[model samples]
Target chain A: MNKSERLFQLVLLLRSRRTAITAEAIAEAMGVSVRTVYRDVQALVLSGVPVEGEPGVGYMIRPANHLPPLVFTPDELQALLVGNRMVQAFTDQDLAKGARSAELKIRSILTEHLKQHAEQQPYRIPILESDDGLREVHGKLRRACEQRHKVRAIYLDEKQEKSERTIWPLGMIGWTGKWTLLAWCELRHAYRNFRFDRFEALDLLEENFRTTSDISIAHYLQSVIGMRDPG
Target chain B: MNKSERLFQLVLLLRSRRTAITAEAIAEAMGVSVRTVYRDVQALVLSGVPVEGEPGVGYMIRPANHLPPLVFTPDELQALLVGNRMVQAFTDQDLAKGARSAELKIRSILTEHLKQHAEQQPYRIPILESDDGLREVHGKLRRACEQRHKVRAIYLDEKQEKSERTIWPLGMIGWTGKWTLLAWCELRHAYRNFRFDRFEALDLLEENFRTTSDISIAHYLQSVIGMRDPG
Candidate 1:
């Protein structure tokens, strides 16, 4: 490794340990001579990088300087990219956008060389397929859910009966290629789930609602499916 | 800023834009003379930090150099410290430990001066009152969750009836003052929500289960509360 790289690694090792690291210990970890470690420590110290403790007593990194920029190994980058891609593919609309934004921010932090490799990296995450119409409706529903806006829709039941309803969207779920919206339905005077594909027309009303506490749409579903007690 | 710092900032600016930056542009950005910008650029190039293009054509960071260490600004560190502290406070056993581990890892990466400041920094995130028991259950539950082992617990229902149960813990929730676990109950043969405060005699079973897909427990909770339907 180059001098800069070695220094960076030394800093990383020192920070990992709670106790002070001796030069001999640092030498062993970096596979360098004790003399080289001493020289490197001196260089770091001279360069205004913090090196705590004397040569024999070991060293501890004093946290007062700016953090080094985030550096990711190739595999790490791949993991993040894949995870973000998955989020964009499967998440609700507002969350999907957030995921995309995060990916962009991460790219901005990468060094020039790594950034190029990242761009050339052909990592792809498989996304579950959903109907185009359903995807569009799910996107709008997600926005309404986030904004706590009221929505009006013509929902078709499992029995194929149509009903007009207004709801304060609380959350949404994607299951087995279908999208489900969990909302506080005004018509039912209760929380209800409506299938996106079964909805003929969905509209975001001007009316907004207060945000509720964090609750699981899955638990509601399990209860609705009789897997758990509704109460 | 020092010449090195200015050079670093200039490189960052060029990389962010994905375009060549002229010495004139660098001088303007750093409020320095063009001569100083030229000298700084030369120094960076001499140090083997890649800068592409001739002087007349402007300079661009070559996308091939290894990134410097991960650095965080003050505001960024504060944000991370706060977010991680919250996660440590409210999350399940495994996640809280992970948060601690992450904090340790972050500390290791800081420059020496920053390390001192970090040690002296009196910024402690206050734990919320409701999730106090979260600290107690965090370690054990986290390990069990990570291992995917069966967990035995004395659970209390809304009616205050106590029942012994074994569950496959899938996720956790921290809301207001309550810590809830989303788990696949072997007893019920379905997913259920159990409050951490209500759990007694918690034990981890030896046998482990296969890892499930990544499902957000929050979404699951919404469904449980009649906010959404599972179908």
Candidate 2:
């Protein structure tokens, strides 16, 4: 790592531990010599990081000296924890994984009080329903939307008429409980919102399309607003 | 707080500190007697919390015995910090405030190691531009949609003709860089997506609307799929 990164790591190392950490331990963790650790500590102290050291004991950062930016009020912490749970429960598996990982990271960083506060928070977004089929489709469409891939799907319309259409996937929008894929349809030659459950099969194509101003989501929404009709 | 809450708080109090805390300090922080603090610590030890108590030094929770749930990988921590910054940069002020507060909470809890990781994540989402008028309008529409309120809006159509419409706000949809109000337009007697910039005036009426099956976002999305045109 760079000098700046090493210095930052040193600070975080000190912050993570509650007791004084010895220069030998710091050197071991940071992959440097005790002399280097001492030099870095000196550099940090010189730069107003308020790192305290004892000759025989070790080093510690005095509380409230630096890093108020990381501090959160109780309610904020509660909200974050709850929000993570909600995301995990509500979104696709990839997002759920991200939320879970995010929550774990958040949990690891919290002080004991905040950790307890999070654990005891009353809110819960229990996984009430889940369909593996829908999750697979959602994940596929989400990836397509992000990567701007075209999708060919056998869709069942309102009247149960089956048709295969290739669409340039723009976005996966969640409306209440349902998910809709907003796309520029090749058959309709218009922007259409395809319902997830109505698709018998979805084939993500390798052919990619450039996001021109005409086919952009903004342009499509403008057409929806009757600002200009692309249909 | 209840007994369970007190027990949890006592555990957290012990966890937050690097050094052993005296019973007097615990009592003062917990708003309990030193005797009660001692009793709680004893209760915690019996409950398998691995609390270490010294007569003169006071008490501390042994490291790694609890709180694995809160720990985060370096990459995960980076994602969260970046995500929060992105939310603050991309969303409206109210959501930005929430994101900021959430970041603070996450920061406050992070061990120095993770804090350093977050700081050195080598990614940024700079606020390139902001429009206060757009933000205000977005905020207003968001609230109306959330509360299912009737909104009276003077809108400029494609022909530049102004028309007053009382609409039931269903959702505020963001497409690319633009935002649209998805509503049940009273004038059109159909679902209409109104672009934010074209709204000449918007009044969030005190009159709220019930989310009937016909007017719900899910139902509207179903219509967008050509399942049934609610128009």
Candidate 3:
């Protein structure tokens, strides 16, 4: 086995054990030399896997180390890769960036022809779906949602007329090909959703939605669930 | 090594070569016994991995297989897992189902303690963000976009005023929390986006956009890119 694969195997062995497992046991179990076991354990500790105990003594993974090193079968990885490509094909800037970074990280683990395959993927995210101001608008709404701030905007209606409005920014949602802002529209005196492309102008206010009333993202979520039909 | 890992390593070795590789060579390459390699190969072929050739003869993977069986490293799996959790937390029914299925498939390959970790995940996707009507609405838009159909709707604007409109449906885009439809509005004679929540009613027409006009999704995409700041 390669060193990376061996190191991964070491991690699995250590994580599987509750009490301290001796280096000799690990070496025997992994079919590697004792010195190699010692060296690999040191590397795991140095890499910060929360493996406790020292060389020649024993190694035990702490229980609080919730996110142990992960591994995905080929099909699982393929699904993720396919999902990322789908996102890049039809989603916003932030998610698109996340997908690219995810792809890069996945590629790093691949080797030889598989690595080459990862580099030269069969599917291509078409150079389609762009809205000049949508990315910027997403940034604005994202910040507003994060900060619990209110926003004011000049919105155009179906009549091709503009209206001034104040809204409590909730969060942004992306459909298959467009972005929409979910918010509490103060002008309409209710929660409303506005298309990202429809916002003629937007700005975040100094006032936060927290001080205004009991309205919140949690409440909004519950409201949606309640809207389901019983029939 | 576990059967799955060993099988994956076997696939990797087989994929690295264009010619048929012997079982003894595969055993030596993966640092496992020849019998173990034979058993793993049987498992792989049984699982429909498309690995070909007999034990005594040699093994080889055909080149025509576009997406060679995928295997995700620890970090790649984690990112995908995190993403799936995020979807269940915030998105609609269709995407939510995709994320759930993705999570299940990823968990299927995990072993021992890691499988337990996958079950009792650290992150809990709180039951927040709901819209019972959204899944149905999303289904409609998805079909509309796929079929390239024209639709008519009674839309309520910010003023709560209703307008009858005929539209050429292009696609749907989701923001952080909602959905929007990108369409060519016949009334205003321009590209328009309608919030799913504000649609008073909708109907799929006898008209298909395929034979209608030359306005392609490519054209709509370019219009957005050209909307960038001129100054």
TM-score of chain B of each: 0.52, 0.62, 0.59
- The prediction achieving the highest DockQ against the true structure is 2
Instruction: Report the lDDT of model 3 for residue B22.
Output: 86
Judged by DockQ cut-offs, the docking class of candidate 1 is incorrect
What TM-score does each of the candidates earn?
Answer: 0.36, 0.42, 0.41
**Per-residue lDDT over B40-132 for candidate 2, one digit per residue giving the tens place of the 0 to 100 score:** 777666656788877778787787544312234454454455445544443456756776777666566566766775644323234435566
Task: Please say which candidate is ahead in lDDT: 1 or 2.
Answer: 2
Tens-place lDDT per residue, model 3, B1-231, is: 645455545666676687898888888987888887788776654333456686467987645344333444443454466456445443345555545444643454455555453333222234333555655665566566656678888999889999999988775544434457778899998888788889888888878876233464455655664432110
Q: Global lDDT for candidate 3?
A: 0.60
For candidate 2, the per-residue lDDT at A113 reads: 80
Candidates arranged by TM-score, highest first: 2, 3, 1
DockQ of each: 0.04, 0.07, 0.05
Native contacts kept, each candidate: 0.05, 0.10, 0.04
Off by over 4 Å in 2: A1-68, A226-231, B1-231
Which lDDT tens digits does candidate 2 get at residues A1-231? 545456656766787888999999999998888899888887665333457789889998866534443556665555455445444444456666555545544444567687665554323233435566777787788678767789999999889999999999885544434567778999999888888889999988999966788886667657674443212
Worst 10 residues of 1 chain A by lDDT: A119-128
Given candidate 3, what's the lDDT at residue B88?
45
Model 2 Cα displacement at B85 (Å)? 14
